[model samples]
Target: MEFGLVLQTDPPAAGVVALMRRAERLGFSHGWTFDSVVLWQEPFVIHSQILAATERLVVGPMVTNPGTRAWEVTASTFATLNEMFGNRTICGIGRGDSAQRVAGRRPHGLASLGRAIDAIRDLAEGREAVVDGTPLRLGWVRDGRLPVWMAAYGPKALALAGRSADGFILQLADVDVTEWMVRAVRKAAADAGRDPARITVCVAAPGYVTADDSPAALAHAREQCRWFGGMVGNHVADLVARYGTDPALVPPELTAYVEGRRGYDYTHHGRADNPEVAFVPDGIVDRFCLIGPPAAHVAKLRRLRAAGVDQFALYAMHDARESVVEEYGAHVIPAFARP
Candidate 1:
């Protein structure tokens, strides 16, 4: 199994180079950057400094909306980066979020994404292919081709990514979703004349654990939820609508449920919150985040690994919670990194 780090929004650009160096020293294999201008500098451009600073650390954008850069220009940009770095370039694509709104393009559907993947792969692989009847070609050759990762959620897009991409990024999925996507990707790979097992499945989720197990842990879980509580990512509203049979908006029970559990940790005294309990109804936050003692957290991660997560990208919402950026580099990583 592999582990990766996510560079948060508002991270100091000045310290990015140093952070990359520290990550390298800490024995982390990869540093995945999120693409959000409102957060800070553009992920790809910021990654340039990081790529220049470190040798072994694989660095790339976790996701960049396709609307911002066309397949041709995107190929050119990443190919140039790959030339400089030799083989450490990954291009991840996702539906336009707020970043897409900034660029004034609507989110893409599964068909659009499937087309984009074909076009981008064509450009990255140096193939003379026509996308949507547009003849496209990247003249430059890439002896060491860059990997392409698609961040997808819906079944259609997941299937497309499964068939086409070098890897897939799962943002809001639990072990169940991750398992489903991995199986889908493997089947897609087989259908595309590629080895299904070759594709990487990177499971990303919120993880923060405190050795003390105090009020701070509960507060940390609430703090984490405050952000996720309102995250209306791709198909979120749709999933909630279709599945939210008894929408919380007009429930028989009072607002007491949200008020109480909204601030409760998913872990109760080092044990997982009862999945049977309707704490949040939707199971959105509870499924993906692990906030508890380190032992319990690692045990839950073992279950995720058993479900086929090749790499677990621990998303640290509050750095103050556990200082995993240090602890992972110190304790957790060494144990996992060993053969």
Candidate 2:
């Protein structure tokens, strides 16, 4: 499995080149960044910064929503980046989420995505381009054979990706769910006359190592809820339901949170009064995170690999422990992704 690291927000802004260089030295094979505009930094800008600095590592934003930029426009951006960096570029897209919705519009229909991917592929292939009646081409050798993948969740999207994309990224779900999605991808690929084994599976998950429950560590995990809250409620609810407490005592304040009705600011502080509630809760840390020690994190990755995961764009622990990451760089990274 290819092991990758996705650093969130500020840490990415300062010393990103150095950070990527360090990751490379530590044996990481690839790096990804979130493209969501508001909560984090713009991924395109961050991706460009890192790719420009690294020579061997495969780097790209984990995804950019179509709503943020139209199909043709997003295609050109990817093509330009690929041209500048050789073939080590990947372009991932997802159904419009907060990352796209907050920007303006959502990627409305499946047909749009199909057309978008088709348009990108066409542009990359340097085929006759009649984009809205305007002819265009990026000089064959092709615009750039960038691997394009879809950020997949449910059946419909997975099937769509199977038909079109070079691969797919699995976000915020358990191994069982991933196994199911993997099967779906394979099934769809077969129906499309393509070999199932070729579709790359990249997973994004939370992994952490807190030797003991430290205040600083616990707090950082809680802060990640700023974005994770909505995910638990919407996408990972099945896993959350299995691991969470009587959703009855979910702090009442967190109800709006689970319902996606709360704002980022309110959601973070809303559950603060009962902060320890999650840290000490039966399944919170385990279900939502792989927190314990290096062994626990390693075990989690092993389980995922067993489920047929090909790559992991790890969003480590809580971005709280620099030491933990350094230790992980020494231990965990080598085990999974040795560049």
**Against the hidden true structure, what lDDT does model 2 obtain?**
0.64
Q: Cα miss at 147, model 2 (Å)?
A: 0.6
Q: What is the lDDT of residue 34 in candidate 2?
A: 67
Per-model TM-score, in order, reads: 0.80, 0.78
lDDT of 1 by residue, 1-339 (tens): 677776654457856667666877787778776675654577777777888888888877767766767777777677777788876877777776656554555676667766777677667667766765889787875674778888865555666887778888877436665666677777777888888778888877666666756777656564554344334222354343334424332221222234334222222211222232234433455565666666656676777778777777766555442366666677666656657
* Count of residue pairs whose backbone atoms collide, per candidate: 1, 0
lDDT of 2 by residue, 1-339 (tens): 877776654454856666776776776788776666676666777777788788878877767665676666676777777777886767777765556555555444666776667677677656645565677666644646767888866556788889888888887535665677788888899999998889998887666566656777655554543344334444333323433534322222222334323323322321323232332332343454555567767788788888888887766434453555576788787777545
| Model 2 bad stretches (over 4 Å) | 9-12, 128-135, 140-143, 212-229, 236-285, 317-321, 337-339
| lDDT of each candidate versus the true structure | 0.64, 0.64
Residue pairs with clashing backbones, model 2:
none
> Which runs in model 1 stand beyond 4 Å of their true positions?
9-11, 102-104, 131-133, 191-194, 232-234, 240-284
